[model samples]
Target: MSSYSAPLRDIRFTLFDLLDVESSFARLGFDEAGRDLVDPMLDEAARFAGTVLAPLNKAGDEHGVRYDKDSGSVTTAPGFAEAYRQFTEGGWSGLSAPAEFGGMGLPHVVGMPLEEMINSANLAWGNFPLLSHGAANALQHHGEDWQREVFLGKLVTGEWTGTMCLTEPHCGTDLGLLKTRAEPAADGAYSITGTKIFITAGEHDLTPNIVHLVLARLPDAPAGSKGISLFVVPKFKVGRDGAVGERNAVRCGAVEHKMGIHGSATCVMNFDGAQGWLVGQPHRGLMAMFTMMNTARLGVGLQGLGLAERALQNALRYARERLQSRSLSGPKYPDRPADPIIVQPDVRRMLLTCKALVEGGRALGYHAGLQVDLAAHAGSEEERRQADDLLGFLTPIVKGCLTEWGVECTYHALQCFGGHGYIAEHGMEQLARDARITTLYEGTTGIQALDLMGRKTMQLQGAGLKVFLGMVQAFCEQQAGNAALAEFVGPLAEKAREWQGLTMAIAKRAAGDPEEIGAAAHDYLFYSGYMVLAYWWARSVAAAEASSQPQAFRDAKRETARFYFARILPRTLAHKAAIETGPAPLLALDEAAFDA
Candidate 1:
């Protein structure tokens, strides 16, 4: 059976040591988020994740979700419903939500590690809350006061679940081509008619009711994306008094039989004149939905990080136990029949790659999470703006790079198991399968790359990049005089300069030809991701040197940092070259000529 243990120590290190989250709490004026409360929450979350969710992962994968055509409902894998019960009872659904709305009102930074732990334990099961978090974010930001009172409380308290219904059969990322229609109703609500596909937790048995945040166009609206509007369509009509009423017109047509995350109910939702209330002003849906989508993107990045951590943990265990051919130089474990696979150079490479990527990623992801807390709670308007800018810039990279690396880490992790990894019993293959979707959903890596290089950088004129560069420069300058940090400071400073120079060059090239943006976009994103990660790695090394933690823990951090700089960071060189190459070679091949 597959196994998972929450990396609580590492998580604490990332939050309390590397990021200094205590100061963040003080700055945000979250008086309730003292060490006494945060530590217990983290400890309990880890225990729940390990004991309740991890065991069900394999069973969930094997049994999957059962869809009943006649009933138009879904039954999740066995134990999933009960586990969700415990999850809600624990008040995890509202961990980061407002206290007035029946939530704990914890810092978003604190929620990040809890989320990572839950996802690591069981990603498919984690989908239930992940969707709720996104849905609550949308409603909290754009919903009318009455709507929040009616819907947001339940979503926060885990009494009901939420889903974002956007993708239809005809379109995925392009919201403009959506054919869903919303007609005006005499009751002051709208009648929604649309078939939204690939809705996560769209129709499930986990809750008493499901709240769907849908996107549809009004009858009098203009064409394309500008015409779209947001709506709150509940499975059962919710009265103003919070009473669950009669069934709505919404129904599940079918649940997708996908390659992975099978325990998650990816459903085809049909709203046949379903009653829905408008979320924001008419024809301004995308603007509001972004509040949810952006949050989901960051959560998805954590999903990647969680999966990689699990993969690395399992691989490390197997590598030390499984004996194979003797080491090339000599057997490291002379007492063994041959030697443990950990002695193999390639095995170490794979394991260390996973290590460097995952730990480096943890630091970056948590820092982004901290930025979220800062943006929401910082006192000064300028502080909030800068935090918002940095958070916006890092979102796509965190989502894209971390998910992509999640895939790569799983590949290496499975390889460490050798032929046994492919077998279902070993559970390595399942991780690989589960990780494949992180890149596809919330927005594909390509879409994220475009958002980073095109919208975030080029369109915003690099305002976010300027803020990030300044942070990196400041970190480098702070560590310049410390002899222990000499190895990292010089290299980090150089990468920061190269990063700025690369962005300027891309901007200049795109000025000449806009198509150049798309061409260089993907590479530039990876380059940016590597540079950001490089900074975090260096910072981690500096932190490790100063920390009074056990020597082994500190050594691990330093070794991982050294590996990242020595191995992973050089990847920027290739991306830099590819970005400079521009769109010519990519556009050279004609569509028809290539096929012939």
Candidate 2:
């Protein structure tokens, strides 16, 4: 198996150079999270991730997880328990949790790169802590004082893991169709009775207790999404004294046999009259869950960026070592039997695609993380509201675009390995398999696309879009006079205008036929994502050019930025055409005719 290493240089560049975490931390009131502290933490995290977690990845995939039917529990792959022990012992799980709850309380900007490093090293192993962060977000925001005292501390301390129980056999993305029941009980709690499927870290042996944030409906509650309520259901019951007690009615009925992330237990949880405390008010579950959902959505985007970074590293290493046909122009290595594959233009194309995607995606993801910090800690209300709006608008784009690009980058990386890539021993195949789920879960690409086009843009009347568009326009105008950046600035300005025009067109059309929104959703999503990336790529070039960095680094950024504009950004043109094609072609075929 190929060894995995965290790309610390690029990560540092992204954090300190592109996102400017030092300034951000200062502004956000995170005094303790300056570079002096964050750097050492990142170094330790990189060591833990690269040395401890990366080695477990292939072994985890091969061994998978063991389900004990009798105990109704799951055991993870070898070394998982000990690795998780070290992970939590290092206080890594609480990197961004609340300080009052036994956490480090760093900004998301710092935590996000650490997250990328871990996910890159071992995604399957990363899932265990990943879900805990989401659960913490939910509890911190909505949990009652008693509830926080009971559950929040353990979650932040990593003594217990957490899971989000929303999906059932009947429904996945559509939470409105959920049938889980939450009945009132005599103890002022509710009895949750239903089954949740595809629960990550649902039932694992790594922790003593598991906290589940479940969504269920009350008998007298109104129908659909509005009637749902959020509850904190533990695997083992906790007393008012905050001690673990007897097992609750919640149990893992079965573990899923999935294509990837086998080390992470994705289980079918059955809640048969399980005792649970409501986190937020009744019928406001969807709103409460958004706190976690939004966090998870952004985390999912990092998962994509992580996998792509790992894939790029392994592919670049292989490309430089593997001997293949001679270079098209001439043999770059005269002494060797044949030139390395890296000498070939086609191979460079694939490699550069991966490079550009991962780097640009990193900037986008980290920028969003900075927005998260601003939303939480900005000094002024106006700054907080603007940051929150931009974060909301970019969530779906980050989740949808990055995951799909992760898949693309992995495929390219695997192709670089040729026949060897298909084999399990090489580990590229595992990365490919794991990348597939990022898009399907959290929310599928189509779901994110719909959210971006319908709910975020049209429903809100482009409030978020206006904020982002303004940023792009301002940047483009500033760079218009810079001759060194004209190649990028001019096109980016044009694309920004087109993006705004497209939104207006879609809004108008949707007013007459709602299907118009659905029709243009997927296309608009890619179009918006590509445009966002274009802006970032341009900014990266400008940053690199103005920096005191070495000439090679600046050259690489300029070259990659050029490649992105010339090759990938043109993809938006196709998306634009497809959007204009409207819903007619897609909806033309009758049901019987489609089947035929």
Candidate 3:
């Protein structure tokens, strides 16, 4: 069975050392979120995750959840309910939620590392509380005052759970094509009727109720994406007195037997005149739901990171112990019959790849989390806007690159174990299976690429891109005289210029041929991601050098950063080349000619 330790040191390094999160939080007016308060919480979370949650992970995967066909209810894998009880009792459910809503009111940056630990410990069980974060966020931002007053506190305190019910059988990516109906009902309530597919945490016994943020259309609403509206539908109705009432019209038709995360209930939900309340203005549900979807997208990226981190830990531990053929040069462990695989150059290559990606990815992901706080709590309006813009630019890059890298790193870690990695005994394959869904969910990588290329960069005229480029140029200029960073700063400066020029090149081509954007979108996203990783890797090296950290730690960071720059960053060349090729290669062939 696989095991997990929270990688607490690395997380601390990312937050306190690299990002200076304490000062960042202080400046953002988070008085109680300093290291003195947050450090103990981290320790407690680590203990809970390692001792309680990690032990349940393998069994959770093997046992999965028990779905009662008769009752339309889901019983989570063994120990999941008790763990969630402790999770809520520990106040982890509301770690970053607003204080007035029964939350700890900590900074979002603080919650991110906790998220990483929970997910790494047990991704399936983590799903139990996952959507509550997004649910509370949506309610806090866009829900009616009465709606927030009724629902937000329960969600924050984990007295209940939540879900995002967006997909239908006929619609996955195209929300505009959804046919769920919401009719006018008494007391400003909505009568919702439709079927929603692939609803994560849709129906479970872990909590008293499940809050569903569903998208539907009204009778007079416009056709297509414009008419969509969001609703808060509960499995068991809640009365105005804050008491649980009779069952609503929503029921889980079936639970999907999935490739992975079987402990998570991916349910097919049927809502037959369920009583829901409108969240925001009519015909503007999609806008409100973006509040939830964006939160979910970032959470999914953290899932990828957490899974990869666990996979790497097990692979590294196994590599050092698993004896194999002698090293080509000579056996380092000649005292034994054979050498551990770590001595082999090729094995080292795979490990280094995992290290570079996972560590580099932690930097990128946490920085994005910090940006989330900056966007919300920064001192000045311009600073907040700039931060928000930078965050928008970084979101797709973090989600797309981290998830894709999660898949890549997991496979490499599995490969490091050779055939044993393929077996269920070691738990590597479980991680590989779990990692598969991250890329597919919360918007697929292709969808993220298109979002980045089409909307954020093109329609908005690269506002976020400009903000990020400014950071890159400023960092490069500040470090120009530092000889240790000269290697990275010079190339980084050049890449920043090339990135701007590449954007201009694509814009020019896209203006003439609209298909150019779609053609270049995927490559452009990966290209942007590689460049972004390069920036974080460089900053990591700088942070390592400037810290009073141990020599070994500093050296590891420098070496991994060097490895990233030398080996991985060059992938951008291929992406850039593909982006330059335009639409002909992708669109040239006739649709009917494929089979021929």
Deviation in Å, model 3, residue 74 alpha carbon: 1.0
Error of 1 at 569 (Å): 0.5
The worst-scoring run of ten residues by lDDT in candidate 1 lies at 540-549
RMSD, each candidate, Å? 0.8, 1.0, 0.9
What's the TM for model 1? 0.99
Q: Tell me the tens digit of each residue's lDDT in model 1 across 404-502.
A: 999999999999998999999889999999999999999999999999999999999887899999989999888889888888889989988989998
Worst 10 residues of 2 by lDDT: 1-10
The lDDT for every candidate, in the order shown, is 0.91, 0.91, 0.91
Cα-based lDDT at residue 499, candidate 1: 90
Report clash pairs, candidate 3: none
TM-score of each prediction? 0.99, 0.99, 0.99
How many clashes does each candidate structure show, in the order listed? 0, 0, 0
